[model samples]
Target: MPTIPSNIVVYNLITKRLFSTSTSKNMNYVEKVRLLDYWKIQDSSLQNEFPRSHLVLMVDRRLLVTKDTPDVKMVEHSYGDLKQLLGEYGLQFDLSNSCLLDALPADNDMIPLFGTSIEAADPPEDSPISKSDVLKQLGNSLGGRFTDIRMAMLTMQEERQRNLLAKFQTLTKWAATYRRCPKCAAALKMRTSKSGAECVTCQKVYYPTFSPVSITLITDPTNEHALLVRHRGSAGGVFTAVAGFAHSGESMAECARREIAEEVGIEVDLIQSLDMSQPWPMPDSSLMIAHVAIAKMDQKISVCPDELETAQWFSRQQVRQALETTLSDPQLKKLPRTLDDRQTLHYIPPAGAIAHQMIRRWVDGKIDFHNSRI
Candidate 1:
């Protein structure tokens, strides 16, 4: 049987290989590695001498990728490479519009390639441009189709690159949205030492924000079946585990129980933390804390029309089969028609998603309810 790649392994490999080249005579390899782990270049002027080759250019929210098989091959370009590409496209690199995502180890010997967002000015507000329209414009500017960041994250093989891209996207969005202080309406300036903005008027600093969400796979008391739900607004015929954002003061477990009850009108007990989390960027930036809980009281489900379109309990055998079908083809697949016309063949969430991971764990008998507390 094949096994999924662990996120920890991918993360470590990315950090190690992101800048593995030998340093200059003045710098040792150990120092370079340490710098890579600890450094963040904040000075804009110092970026001039930074190597262009190591830079990851994010134009708008899309990264430059090759138009080839797998379709997730990202282009690793240096500053010179970027200049040439921009010249060919009749565009210029505007530093004022760019920001440092990460800096290199040595003082001015910055490897600016770590994280950078370089793009032309954004369209004015009230222009009402759709995402597809923006992507089309970017594709023209880059000489290749601009893939959505979410799609790239899903298909990309390099976990490190994917994570970096997500961070870049999040940072870019944060910078744009928090240009002014929320309290006093004062213009916020970027702090030179870290990824934060400070207000000149109120002395308030604004950093990137991430919301917490709870996603759970609920099983019957006997653990013989799992609950699956179809969201009213979900794309495709896909069903997923019950999920909801954690309220301002709610615990993750409390959020999980509340979400289950509110979405499907059922109570869940024995909520055991899966201790697995994933950064989800869609709709908003959030950390999804995955969990497994047992359905308490009756098995009957009363779906909340506003929250879910359908809710049903699938037996362990059915869930295992579903996972097998999903694993065989990572893309959405359609099964043969059944007598029940209302029940269509639906796909599960992609593998990288915490929801899918939780389901896979449950299907593999890796999740234990015996140790769970009420």
Candidate 2:
């Protein structure tokens, strides 16, 4: 058994303790949702509970979700049903790779959710099932279709389900991508209840990887305006807070400062951290850390042409408008080009995104940089 990193261990302990308590006033949706708690169950008991537990299947990275309005629900299957379906599809349900993702709330029966993935079945030449036929047949049988995970995340009404899908996708992607150990090209087996994997030859355990990204909303000295930038290939008239991945051993705050300088050629001091961290799974798994940076003085708007199309400050009202637009229509992709005009309307990220939360907090005065850091 490979030793888990001490920092990760400490983080898990602290978060588990905090979430297990009743003090949920300030906790975010992700924090409020109950993650995997399989350590509480014995292996023998886990098997007994599996048949009754709800199964969330991810076929080729898409989530199985029922078509509905306002709230999208993940299609749940029994373990026996799952086994039978996989057998029909020429696939196997590996118990070792079945990951417990989340537990429903007390009012919802507190049923445990087991997430497992099955590759698209490549049927035999003589078989009637085609390459893409599995998805259609499974959808017909389950009364749901395989939905794009991103679309499912956006339309999901319940925050708990959204968080569960994010976790499930991240874990599933990690397992699928890293089949062999880095040190030795040996087959890896699921370990720690599929939360991690261990190399068969080296006995080294690999944990899920989440790259840390610093997303900061920069405010001027007056705190009346916020700085947002648009990448070259980004949607028209859409701008978002500065974001960059932290380099090795670099603090998140420093990463924010460096990104600000590199993208917009401005210097900013960290105001404070916000309670807006999110686990994003697109492009790659990332832990988005939110913060506020204040430009102590007037700064030039020298845009890094290689990095950004434009960088400019917008009034609180503008930011508010963009947020409202996002709320009214999250699917709105095209906006009138106005990155040059600081007074005009511009859009921010969707409400589910941490960047959107950061901007909203700044506008709502929740992120008061005027107050001294306690």
Candidate 3:
């Protein structure tokens, strides 16, 4: 039994989008230095100061799983170079095994991860390059540079998240513990990133935030209402926004139209994207893309008991009140959250999931709350 919705953990604090992990920005000190041509060749002197963090080794980067670790160092890399490794040791990146972690603290910017093999460097007992030195090196490597760094300070003037106490529980048998590479079936090596997961195996990558799929917010113009469907396994006949996966060669808006037709027998016209996002962790993983759509020129309503148990239209007020929040439609009814059941764990979306997030955006002005174009 997990307190977290499946693999998802409710954020302990409310801050920026990088709400879970501190974004890599406003470094009181962030610099870049040339990888001292020779230092790039050694390591005997490297293990202690920057000893490979076991946790970091297992997973490239981490999102403050325990809130606080007195001694934690942060690194930022907008652009990096493998040239030093190439020039110094004649070692090339196993391009097939490298990855980039770019977790967003906000909508546009993200933190990045840059890595190379520990086996490549020459051992040396000297101070590591300064952030500016490294920045300089990075600038030089990319045929340019920037030593000054800027970032969002909403974390400082407002409130720094209270670091929670640390606890460790081994989910050795948890299938979610491992991920699959899109290119190959091999197990993925989870690394830290400003974005999301890093796969060291196939080199194919994934971000904590990925693609978004959407649901149709269909309505009955005559009745001034919308429709919702109850899936068979939902909570106590708990009803929710109608949704499903988008097919290939489909747009978020288009997916919304299709899912509505298949699940509840409705073909919509005037469709528009509301918002796009990823599902929470507890129940499952999905990039929720939300859309609002209406019948082309007339009323439309039909049902397919095969895909859903019941599909009916609800007034705007019904949806607003049921959500508990302006934009949410909680899964008051849900299936067992088990580690072993594929449909239960893998197929299901995270509870209080991103699906709600997209809707929330719709409720707000971020998405066209009154329009039908995404």
List model 2 lDDT by residue over 1-374, tens digit each. Answer: 12556765566667667755634354456664433443322244356556667788888778888865556878888778878877875777765556777654443234457888877756778987676676778776767888888777656667677787888888877877778999999998755345677788988878889899988888887888888888777667668898878889778888888878888998886556776787778768888889888895476778788978787788888888888887787755556656454324456766666777788787888788667565
RMSD each, Å = 9.2, 6.6, 18.4
Candidate 1 residue-wise lDDT, 1-374, digit = tens: 01214664465455435445534445556656544443332243334434353555566666767665553656655677667766764566644445455444444343644445665455567769865676566555554566677767666666556666666677667776887899999888764323678788997877888789999999888887888998875644566899999998889999999999899999886688888887777768888899888885376799899888788888778877767767776755454344343244356766757777888888888888776554
Task: State every prediction's TM-score relative to the real structure.
Answer: 0.76, 0.76, 0.42
RMSD of 3: 18.4
Q: Could you tell me how far off, in angstroms, the CA of residue 365 lies in candidate 3 after the best superposition?
A: 10
- Per candidate, the number of residue pairs that clash is 5, 0, 45
Find the 10 residues in a row with the least total lDDT in model 3: 161-170
lDDT measured at residue 14 in model 1 versus the true structure, 0 to 100: 59
State which candidate has the highest lDDT.
Answer: 2
Q: Which parts of model 2 have CA positions greater than 4 angstroms off?
A: 1-49, 83-92, 104-111, 122-137, 303-307, 333-346
Better of 1 and 3 by TM-score: 1
Relative to the true structure, how large is the alpha-carbon lDDT of every model?
0.68, 0.73, 0.38
- Model 1 score (lDDT): 0.68
- Which residues of candidate 1, in runs, are more than 4 Å off? 1-41, 44-53, 58-60, 66-73, 99-110, 114-145, 192-194, 333-345, 371-374
